[model samples]
Target: MRALDLTLVLTNMPTTTTLRLSFSPSPPRPLSNRACPHGPVISQLDFFAFLNRHGSFLTPLSCCSLEVDRRRRSPITMLSYDSTSNVLANQFQVRELNDETDFETILSADGRFSVCGFGSLLSERSARSTFPDLVNFRFARLNGFRRVFAHVTPVFLERGIARPETKEISGLSVEPCEGESLTVTVFEIEKSEIPAYFEREIEYRFLAVLPQTLDGKPFDNPAVLCACYSDEEFLRVRCKGSKEMFFQLYGQYNIDKIWQDDILPCRAYLRHCVLAAKKLGDEVYDNFLDHTFLGDRKTTIRQHLATKGSGIMEEEPPESLKIRYGG
Candidate 1:
């Protein structure tokens, strides 16, 4: 039998306990331990909550094997055990953490932080490049938002894909809409790996959202977060249109001074996002087409797909782009 060692600290109290469990492929036996007289009851109660959530492997034990470490401590960092992976297979439930959730608590809780992707990140390859250690790369739906290719960004220009002449200089962003939901990919990454992530997702402000699983279940954690929408200030400036908003949001990036309505999506980037969705399966592809829209928010991707414009999203990147940008 292999022993699983778990050390926990209860934020609601001031105590620490180290627990050890011996595991096998059989039913669990009733195990018991006495809480140290000095330890608070919270130290014992939260222990049960943790175990209860880890599959149906353990019953509501009245007591737990606890070794008191009386010295004050920070939240214990999570240690992964092989036996726990199976329990994590379906972690779509409500999170106990809040918006101002403690970093140490979040980082140590199995290192499970979610990132929502409704655009190019629908591609596993694209997402993995940013979050190499990501796990549970799965699909979910974000309610109360809709996708639109209206965020004017410098990334397209940096990659040499912008068409300022045709106003195809926009990336993707989401806007709040009552009773609307967008299909998106949700994946887990360690909190420690996100410094570079902020750089890649510089245009949008990341916020915590509870995306619904395919089966309509809530995720166990709400820290599944990423930048998908503009902040209030950006929205206020965006009223002047995509071009004006871009200038206000990023001053130095506008070296070319070529700003426009951003009525169309960046050709190369849009095509990449569309093809990535297609590869996820029919549902995702259909969702991308039916739910996505241009800056006007009136023309759907599907409607555009029915026109000659479809060729832009289906054909290869331009010859000039090939020298600068790969698929």
Candidate 2:
């Protein structure tokens, strides 16, 4: 009776540690399971270990559990509030979560807006910690977009997610894709608070998007949020002229490095993001697995989780940045 989030994820578990990719704009290192000279290169083993530990894989939590429990299959995805009515009942439909996109509507009301969240902000705990007064904290989906962990950030380092000893660090971002959607959180903040949010999300592009409710209906208005994509030209457009001014206001540096750099997701932050998705319920968790990807744009979080889910989530963030910066 749980709704399958975004039904997507295609990954092949690599047997070795060294990355052998055949793509031009590849990540600077291995997608994951990077071969460290000091350690054994074991990836798939971690996945099986997770299965063994959990006994029967639970729905939404396990990797690709939508097709699980062949003996007890059921119809009807979940019980969420109706997009239009904000009421829940048997007629509550999963179909509404996957709405068809109308580009014209999205473009019409992008400017005067509030904020949306796809990454850490998806966590109400993290959201409230950052924006104490955020209101209308609700779920929405941004169509024609997919979330990925492609861009680099020092925040990971400061959070101790990225230690100096590990493979370089990367964070999450959203990019344009056809026939794709992600469950994101949207909230309203005072106009006076925009500067603080901008600074917190310095290395990102403020994307204007039309967000929809669980039942395939658009919000009365559009929203703008830092999508953390790596398109400089697009950043210029979204920056409202002079990306430099935008950066200065946000107190960000290394603009070129943030985009052009290659790094992998820190286990700690990756675990945090995946756990955040998990908190949104089974559907949102599955949606995250299906859409979220490593920097390569080829590796799925499901693929990674399937093999090393236990270790990654259990692994501790490095003391590199925390010790250096005192976070």
Winning candidate number (lDDT): 1
Model 2 ranges off by over 4 Å: 1-113, 228-256, 260-262, 308-310, 316-327
Could you tell me every candidate's TM-score relative to the true structure? 0.58, 0.56
Say what the RMSD of model 1 is: 15.8
State the C-alpha lDDT per candidate.
0.57, 0.54
Q: Residue 156's C-alpha lDDT in candidate 2?
A: 63
Model 1 per-residue lDDT tens digits across residues 26-52: 333322121111112344335444435
Task: Give the TM-score (vs. native) of candidate 2.
Answer: 0.56
lDDT of 1: 0.57
Superposition error at 90 for model 1 (Å): 15
Model 1, poorest ten-residue lDDT window? 31-40
Per-residue lDDT of 76-140 in model 2, one digit per residue for the tens? Answer: 22222333543333221111111113112233232223577887777877777778877778999
